[model samples]
Target chain A: MASNEEILAGLAEIVNEETGLATDAVELDKSFTEDLDIDSISMMTIVVNAEEKFGVRIPDEEVKNLKTVGDAVNFISNAQA
Target chain B: MARKVVITGLGATTPIGGDVPTMWKNALKGVSGAHTLEDEWVAKYDLPVHFAARCSTPALEVLSRVEAKRMDPSTQFGVIAAREAWADSGITEIDHDRLAVAFATGIGGVWTLLDAWDTLREKGPRRVLPMTVPMLMPNGVAAAVSLDLGARAGAHTPVSACASGTEAMHLGLELIRSGKADVVVCGGAEAAIHPMPLAAFSSMQALSRRNDDPEHASRPYDRDRDGFVMGEGAGALVLEAEEHAIARGARIYAELAGTSVTADAYHITAPDPEGLGATRALKAAMFDGRIQAEDVVHVNAHATSTPVGDKPEYTALRAALGAHVDNVAVSATKSQMGHLLGASGAVEAVLTVLAVYERQAPLTINLENQDPEIPLDVVTSARKLPAGDIVALSNSFGFGGHNAVIAVRNV
Candidate 1:
């Protein structure tokens, strides 16, 4: 019912428990450790769940490629396209 | 030889009671800690297993709404347990660097995560709260405990399925022995009693469904055994180096001599049928303690009520300790306390330490029928050890093929 960007923005509500940042925080840029304070473990779960939810076949290594909310939204958009 | 570590404080939030005194009182009196859930899920979804060993009381009864809103149930239980342990330790002022925390959880922040998902689906994107993530992290308890104690040595968390708490205490021993911390707060917490988790576990055939008689529902090692009953709570201990405890005139509980963990890398849901990992973990703990199997007087076994999970632990203990199996009095505590998941092993370890200190071992409830295949000295009611010196071992194995055992001796 929602656009890919909107879906991603919605999913960001899952929140990174460590830093309390919405994965979709507009300020949440590509750099995780620096900008969002999301550690590798939290990032791992977020990516895996996002991949599953969006049907985006994120590869094992490529999951780390996503750095920002925009990047995740792009991946989801491209996959759904 | 390594520096000795001792338990200076203890805390638990369990079905029988919320604090150590109430839990211990009920535990000693052999009161049943199992009960039915009044949750909306019971009538809404018709869950096959409607009963569980909930905390003896609600969390909000002890913690403020501000604190409750900020933390996941697991972290809140952890904070309550840790607060009790810290208060028990008697020392108010501590060097932030010298103090450390190692609290663990098998399933952390599930409530927060699930609630956030529901919010996202129902309320839309912008309406989701900002604090969902921090409230649900597995390390949330350790972080909160660290913040509370101003601990800077490290806030370590080991998510080894159900064995998480035992491993946490084991890590505390290492932290103190490694000279990285003079005093360490350690334990395990689990609050995964939500409808989804319960239904999921039920679907996996891992939960006991005898809802009518909740108290007798969790029957481990019995012929009528179905599966483990889910429980939620936390347990914690304040561990300090002997030198530090002695300097501060703290009452030493017992010496935590050795601890070791190993991975089975075996199965996803089921334990290794042979329990080879558990065997090695026992060996490692004893060898590290420089103690022999003959010295272990009692054990706290990780005996969840699944059909395939109970016996391997006994077989492994037998293989590792050999004929001394007759001497080892085993207490499958989950029979009474319900399975605390991550908190189970740690809470059992606390019970084990209390047994060693007081010379009294708690009873293994609901063990009506001992599996003929399994061979061990399981305490039926309560066993009083003779007034003599003794050593003990507490074993905890997890879902991800993780096995951890810790050895303790009279201080």
Candidate 2:
């Protein structure tokens, strides 16, 4: 099992694929576009990654509520729980 | 015969510049915004493409950190451009019910999506960001612009792939002409320069990879053309009914004369090789404008430079306009700005209106040798149009075989 930090690091690979930015735990608090320069289409890739990783598909209705990294992490955690 | 919709004000945040005036100035000067991207993933993942057209002017420069943190780059751009358009209209007092917004994007929230994925994969899902969805919605731009303008009429988004933005404009025209709203802030936005899309497009060979020379990679209509260069930004226009605009003393740029849209229903990413869908759209638009085909001498073409994509537009024009096609001078602005995907049409429409208003059609850049098969008078150099005001048409086609046309004439 991975530590929370390891889990976050695993998530970074997803962000890296979507954003083209290979970030670390230090950059997790960063806004997607500002600190990391990720664009809109990249977010869709993240949702897809979370869905596959957590085995829970977030629907379009709930997808609109996500705005930050924490939101995605919480959504996945809650689903996995 | 019916109510006419006209452009009152315009705004844009593009790769070359931010705001309407700056963007227009840079566009006329033929500035190239494409640059080689430096990212760790390029080395780690070994992504094929090495460059993209990032906004020379970022939205954050005009927005606060708090404001910037809330929206995706696409929505941030929409709000920035919309605010500029509203201020440019010189209408300080507006009735909320009479105002509306229509902003569309091909893809949205990519950054948020990917970042959230990273949070879940490594951080055990509990550490994922909270605002992922809000930042990534496809209608985020429409929501932002509508809120900024206090637009009560409605906020609509038409996501028809690359044609999304132009479709939004056409919808805005319909809204005003149908008496639903007196004014509409309309445009398109896109921010998809991330590695996944880059890799996806690269795999499809839909992007230019001449990494050595980013500036000349987006060569449309040239015999050596390979693929388009992805670009990011937004373009917006303020449109109003002639009566409302005149009563409010708004400066009318040009009349939204007519518009038409059609779908190929053929290929998901390719046009009807014969230009069937495009021909129908052009004919309908010309008929709607109530103008003879001869009157339209200029076209702000949607030439994305993909070898297969550039030729069909010319074929469609020749089939649709026949003899009039020879007299038409096509301006492929994508030649300079790469392709803004969904926002390309709206940006070109804004440029076309300026061309008509200024009586100077900016030439297609990077067109050293035109393809011999494309039999039309493409304006290779910026030239002043001859006397006499006339109707001009804007065409936008999307990946899903969706197509839209808009006609503008001097008021």
Compare the candidates by lDDT and give the number of the best one.
1
Give TM per candidate: 0.83, 0.83
For every candidate, C-alpha RMSD to the true structure in Å:
9.1, 8.7
lDDT of 2 by residue, B248-324 (tens): 88889998888888999898897899999999998988887787788887888888889899899999988888888
DockQ of each: 0.03, 0.04
**Which stretch of 10 consecutive residues in model 1 chain B shows the poorest summed lDDT?**
B123-132
The residue-by-residue lDDT of candidate 1 on B1-411, one tens digit each, is: 688899999998987779987877666566567789999987799888898899988899998764586789999999999999899889877788899999999999999999999988996654355667888888999999999888999999989999899999889998899899999999999999899899989999999988888898777778788899999899999999999999989999898988999999888767888899999999999998888888888888888878888889888989888998988888777888799999987788778888888887777778777888876788887688656678878888887899999887888
TM-score of chain B of each: 0.97, 0.97
Please report, as a value between 0 and 1, the fraction of native contacts recovered by candidate 1. Answer: 0.00
Candidate 1: residue B273 Cα off by (Å): 1.2
